[model samples]
Target: MPPLLTGSLYDAYGSYALVPAPLPVVAATALVLTATGVRRAVSHRAPAVAPH
Candidate 1:
């Protein structure tokens, strides 16, 4: 019974610890995607070559 309780507690703590790990990755991906989209939009609107 003691071992079972310990395992359950360990599993709970491990799960809680893992919960916050992906947040930064998700935020960074969103930022990169947004920046890429904005850059593409701006590029498409501007002329390809500048005239003197």
Candidate 2:
């Protein structure tokens, strides 16, 4: 038996109590943008092979 609450059960809001705030947002955004760019670059750089 546990106390029922709203949102996440693990208390995500409490995380800010330990984190520096902006650091987390910036890190997450950078990671997503990097992944998107890398995927696009790889797809565009592929070479087509022709039968000899």
Candidate 3:
């Protein structure tokens, strides 16, 4: 597998390098974000109880 970004950009006067994140890091980040979103949604949908 290749990194998300590759190669460099060149312009009339200068060149810039492109760095890509490792696949594992990207996957981990996505998983965490998704879990957080799902958790928030579930909590919002759950009913709240009141104590006497």
lDDT of 2 by residue, 1-52 (tens): 1233323333767543434435677789989999999999999986988899
Quantify all predictions' global Cα lDDT against the true fold: 0.72, 0.63, 0.60
Instruction: Arrange candidates by lDDT, descending.
Output: 1, 2, 3
lDDT by residue for model 1 over 1-52, one digit each (tens)? 2455546755878644555555788789989999999999998896779688
Best by TM-score: 1
For every model shown, the clashing-pair count is: 0, 0, 0
Q: For model 3, state the Cα shift of residue 42 in Å.
A: 0.4
Task: Please list the residue runs of candidate 3 whose C-alpha ends up more than 4 Å from where it truly belongs after superposition.
Answer: 1-4, 8-21, 46-52
Listed in order, each prediction's TM-score against the native is 0.53, 0.51, 0.51
Model 2, position 12: C-alpha lDDT score: 66
Model 2: number of backbone collisions:
0
Q: CA lDDT of 33 in candidate 3?
A: 99
Q: Model 1 segments beyond 4 Å from truth?
A: 1-14, 46-52
| Number of the predicted model whose lDDT against the real structure is largest | 1
Q: Residue by residue across 1-52, what tens digits does model 3's lDDT show?
A: 3422333223322433333334578889999999999999998895878798
TM-score, candidate 1, is 0.53
